[model samples]
Target chain A: MQAAADLGAAAPSRRTEILDGLKITLPFMVGAAPFGVIFGALATSQPLHLSPFETMALSLFVFSGSAQFVAIALMAVATPAWVIWLVTFILNLRHTLYAATLVGYVRHLSLGWRFILSAGLTDETFAAMEDRYRRLGVHRNSHWAYLASIIGMHVNWNCWTMIGIAVGMQMKGLDGLGLEFAAIATFIGMVVQKLRTAGAQTAAAVAGILAALLAALPYKAGLTIATLVAIAVAVIFERHLERRGQA
Target chain B: MSVGIVILGMALINLVLRCPLFLVANHIRIPGIIEKALAHCPVAVLTAIIVPFALHLDQAPDGSQWLNPDLFATIAAVAASLLTRNLMATIAIGLGVAVSLRYLAVF
Candidate 1:
């Protein structure tokens, strides 16, 4: 029973930890909010209609900005709803990688806990956690810290969506000032964080340029191809380096 | 038949592909090719996603346009991010550049 009390004390501390994590992650929302606002505004302009509730649900549940954008764009063209959803789903298939990484951290928790944590898993969260784990060896309690980071992010995202909806309703020019550039800033930060060696930076630059060359393919399939190619090239190079004891 | 199925199928395949990686983390000896691929996953994934958005904004001669708001904003944002490394400053500059250019009729 005393152990239970100790665990309870730890729980409140976890909440505090989560709060602190939010402070660290708040800037990510700067990018996220503009994406949401663009989504809300773009969806509003379309003839393919959704109730506000549906729009909210799409953002809340689907929770993918690019996929959501594509889905709405397709819907505006009278594409079947299933096709739009399917494409969005496929586009976001990468989230599974995020989920899988997180599973190792939280699979031992209760099913409900696992479900909740999995729902909150996202690219930023996954990257943040991956960087954390790589820097500090895995700990049993690391999931809690990662979860705290995500909780901070979750509040920022949802609240900003509400703000976007409000501003989208009343404003016309919010799309000005290139707020979407925030995503570029965010990506640069992510890339900088991921740079552990010269090889990684080379791989990133090659992939960035290659993906740009292939950006016009149908259904964005060109992107998938470019990514696979870049990965293949980098992997081969890294292995050669490793064999030479030069990595 | 529904797009949801596609979405769900993609999700399933992704999980299945990765499940082995996680479950076999200790048991299996991964091939060198796979190791190299894993090393580049961050770059590949980021490049794959960011590029399309960056180039989405382009201009048509007729006045109707697809402009690269992301690209323009990214340029400014990257500069700011590299300079300040302050999250707020980078995003603000990026967003400000994209939106201002957008509404200023600069195309």
Candidate 2:
């Protein structure tokens, strides 16, 4: 009887974590909704001839927004399968960075928990989880929050993609409505709030300039290169500061 | 060459990249410097993604690139974010400015 009561007491806290996760993820969902619709709309049009089911399945399984759009553009040109695969891998290489950043906090979780959490590590989810973990530190209930975030985004993305596919089939120009700006705005909001330190600010400025300068690079390779270099710069700056302090 | 095969391959690639560290998180230790560097990953990666999109860098050199509504809206959004520190407010100001500018441009 006492054990049953304890389990009941613990359940609500987990529920609260999930609720909090959903709340935090709401803005990201709003941001992604248009992107998903645009993807769905684009995939069904032009030289690319994806069926609705194929379009939805891409979102359902691969679940990377930029990657899916890249694939669609390549497929329109009848780009070879191997090239598409290579590009997808390269485009998503940043996920490895995200996983690396988050591994320490989740190291204590079971294999199943880790697997589930890692599977949904998109940019928005990563931002949300990283913000939460950095601000609050990890606790026993943190995985529940991570789980809720991934699930919320996963469902929201797939549903919106389907809506886009449906709307694309019936309409002519839903993509022209400037809906994608929401995502850029959302990213700005997330990125600005986190630029609280000089080191972070310098890192962001370096990454932004390099990315813009190198934007002409093929297959979105510039993004990865810029991020890696910016992180290196920030690390070196910190080390310099440390040495100065010691002197 | 089926789309199904491509989708499966992409999914596998994503899984491989994301899962290995988590799957082995307890077994290995990251070096101190590398761990410290990873602390900067979010800002670096996110800013990289945002800059190209917000700046219209991918578009061909047109004199009007600097006059982009999206760029103005992004600047507005950044200011709103710094002032309010609220995500919804930032997006609202951004979209509001963007829509209004586009509407005026159309007329």
Candidate 3:
């Protein structure tokens, strides 16, 4: 991929921001490692029986964990390819919401930069990028930080996917490894790092409970619904606070 | 069925939903209220995403229901993160406890 277009004099310091972004994102990489392994192992199992190559191809291309898992599960059941496509599409439909929210930061870039960044835009990268944008706002070096978030997550994901597939082709069960729980730690770490206010904390807690309650909703629709409702709750609550000068 | 062919189709659809929004982003105007609301989006999204996975409905080997190692590990992780304020340390303690719980089958 192409580097994000340099913002002239701001380019030099961006190199450091890029490093900082990668350093901060290290925990996420560690957290996602187990899930990646599980996905690889699942791809090769009964019903799916996909060769390691096919599994890798899915990870290499789709790069969406939930989407790939849904696809493989659907394929295993001989669900029509179109249904798998549709379901995965709906599951990933949340990406559009993330893109709309994130585009505010990158709207001034060239189409090439926008497109490349878009390809790297997964749920993980979206969190990391949006955090940087919020923390740093519209600085010149901010684009480089964004680029670092994308490349760091992209490489980390693909690398783990390949390793999982490689080990899966050789071994049997990876779940016994118990590494998948790292994703929880990673998410927890990230969430704690950003809980700078009571409103943010409230939104997170509400979203968590709502997600568990609504998880039975089909097609992962619960996540999107819970997020929207939680955002509304937090925003409304904050506005109320502001009225009394507490905000 | 060609797995490769199906994957390519999914890839195409994924790209369509992801890319065009950025292209169209230049045309839209975000109100101050909407932008402030959007500020809440990342934390909300990440929280919702993590909770389901942490308390996954899948059964444990010991036939326990609704209680699992992930829940404890997550609580431990949050506490460690708050106290230590260090990412690597939080992950290490969290994953260590989770794996240990699963191995010991204390649940």
Best by DockQ: 2
Give the per-residue lDDT digits (tens) of candidate 1, residues A4-105. Answer: 234443343555546645644566656577667656655543343344555665566656555555555555434445545444444455565555555555
* Alpha-carbon TM-score of each model against the true structure: 0.61, 0.64, 0.61
Candidate 1 displacement at residue A54 in angstroms = 4.3
CA lDDT, every model vs. true structure: 0.57, 0.78, 0.73
Candidate whose TM-score is highest: 2
Name model 3 segments beyond 4 Å from true: A1-51, A63-114, A121-157, A168-171, A174-177, A215-224, B1-18, B21-28, B52-64
lDDT of 2 by residue, A1-247 (tens): 1232344434447888899899899999998887787678767754455889899889999999867876775565455677677767755776877888888888877889999999888999999989988776676676788899999999999999998888668644444445456656766876798798777888899999898887777766677788778989988988888899899
Tens digits of per-residue lDDT for model 3 on A1-109? 1223443455548679889778767877777777687678667654356898888888878888767765775565354566566655655666777788788778877
Error of 1 at A126 (Å): 6.1
Which order, best to worst by TM-score?
2, 3, 1
Model 3: colliding residue pairs: none
> Which order, best to worst by DockQ?
2, 3, 1
| Candidate 2: clashing pairs of residues | none
Which window of 10 residues has the lowest lDDT sum in candidate 2 chain A?
Answer: A1-10
Model 1 docking tier (incorrect/acceptable/medium/high): acceptable
User: Which stretches in model 1 have alpha-carbon errors above 4 Å?
Assistant: A1-51, A64-108, A123-156, A172-189, A192-196, B1-39, B49-72, B102-107
